[model samples]
Target: MTKDPKVVSFERTPAYLHHRAMLNRRENNTIDALELMRHAVERSPENREYRLDLAELLYEMGCHEQSNKLLLDLLAEDDGPSECYYGLALNQLGMSDVSGAMKSLKLYQKRDPNGPLLGEVARLAAELTLYESMNRPVSRRLYRATRIADRACEAMREDMPEKACRLFEKTLELASEQYEMRALYAMSLCMVGKVGEAKRNADLAAKGFPPSVRALCVCAQVYGILGEDELAFEMIRRIEDEHPYETERRLFIYTLGEMGLDERAADCARLALQETPYDRELLHVRAIAMKRAGADDRAVAGF
Candidate 1:
């Protein structure tokens, strides 16, 4: 018997794959979406839209360098869409290349003054201008330092703690006052068995009044790693006192989980869930935290 047309096997063309990728992305299946998007791009190497879409997915996935390269290649095309410049600017920002981002933004504005992303472009431009004016002479050095720190963060995320440590050290050499970077450097140091140095950096980061949520979280992790429970708890307390935003709250919860404070993580996640009822990520985090804390029934309900 013949299968229904809808159930028949169709040729997986580039367009089909691209559409499927977008659907997967909408469903939050990012890994599968990326794979499908890659296949689409590979099959349609000459298709600018496919390439642009792939680059955008890469950018969203934190593959900044890869996305930037693709965007740059698109920008080199005489007939490329002006959107390439806007995407390039975003990737540049992700890489902490403030100057490069500014240049790309200018190009984008010149090419498409009435683009759909004009408002976003203008907002980013205004923010960058304010950032540069605030720091003035030291802005350039800070930007360079931030670029190194971004590399360090990528290394950490890739599980290359030693490389991250080296890059963070270089970042600190240029901008020692970057408490967040220092905190991350401390975490990297601890990962690489440099407990003493980690403690020193973490202590320094914690010294900043009203420490950033990232700094507090990293310092807490470093202290926990060093068996300094008191200090770790102190950092956690500070995080609670700061009235952190949603992103910071997520970080705080994850930090608690990292320090093996599952009950606290669960509690924090529950509190955050009350604030953001529809956040799938918060629900997932809360489920995991609850599971780890042995609240099996609540965990099951959460899932």
Candidate 2:
């Protein structure tokens, strides 16, 4: 029997697999997406877009070194996209190569002055410049505190709130002015049933000058967990008044969900999705929010 033309075309073309991989990623099926993306890359070895997508997925999965190597290989090609420099900079930052990241950012700006990522590139460049300008002792202390805070964040993600609390305490001792970390510390405290201490830290973080989005979100989460709905809503209002980045917007959505404002969270997620329709993380957040709000149809469609 002869094979069907559609089946032959689907089997032979990498674009179908690539498109499917993107859809799976949007649904937060990262493992399946990774496998599908890998197959697509294998089938179309010379396709730079496929390889770059694979590298970005690897970075999202925390395989920083692998992503960096792939990005480096892409840059070695004379006709590589200027976007590779931005990706390289991200991977370098992930690996703690601040100097290298700065260099890559400069190259990216030089090559693509009108790129879509101009805002992100400028923000990252300013942050890197601030870090580099710090004196050696201050820089070292901040780096140490950041490393401890990273471990604390990992502990929180792993559901070890007590461990995260201890790590955050150590981090605060080294960098006392990091109100964002203090807010996160408050969240860990709340997670472990230390409501009084959590409230204290949250209040202090909320009082910090020029409140940051993450600090506000963490404080809101702590207040919500402590049954202080008024304070929590105020924090959410403050976040809304600010022009937060995508990650911060995600945090705001999560804080709303944590406070049982599922419908509001879904609305915010939908607004964010309108800006970056293909963002897998935002899609995942929106799906969860819609599900919680009893919008089964929309939630199912998202997934």
* TM-score of candidate 2 versus the correct structure, residues matched by position: 0.60
For 1-303, candidate 2 gives per-residue lDDT tens digits of 987576433364699889989999899998899999999999998999999999999878756667878888888888788888889889788657898999999999998999988889999999999987773345788889988998999999999999999999999999999899999999999999999999999999998879799999999988988999899999999988996766688788888888889888888988987865645566777788778788868445945
Question: How high is the lDDT of residue 131 in model 2?
Answer: 89
Q: What is the C-alpha lDDT profile of model 1 across 1-303, one tens digit per residue?
A: 976677666799999999999999899888899899999999999899889988988788766667878888987888778988889888788667888899999998998999998999999999999987886546789889989998999999999999999999999999999899999999999999998999999999999766698899889988998999999999999998997766678789889899988888888878877855544566778788788888868445946
Tell me the RMSD of model 1 versus the true structure.
8.1
Ten contiguous residues with the weakest lDDT in model 1:
275-284
What's the true lDDT of residue 42 in model 1?
94
> What residue pairs clash in candidate 1, if any at all?
none
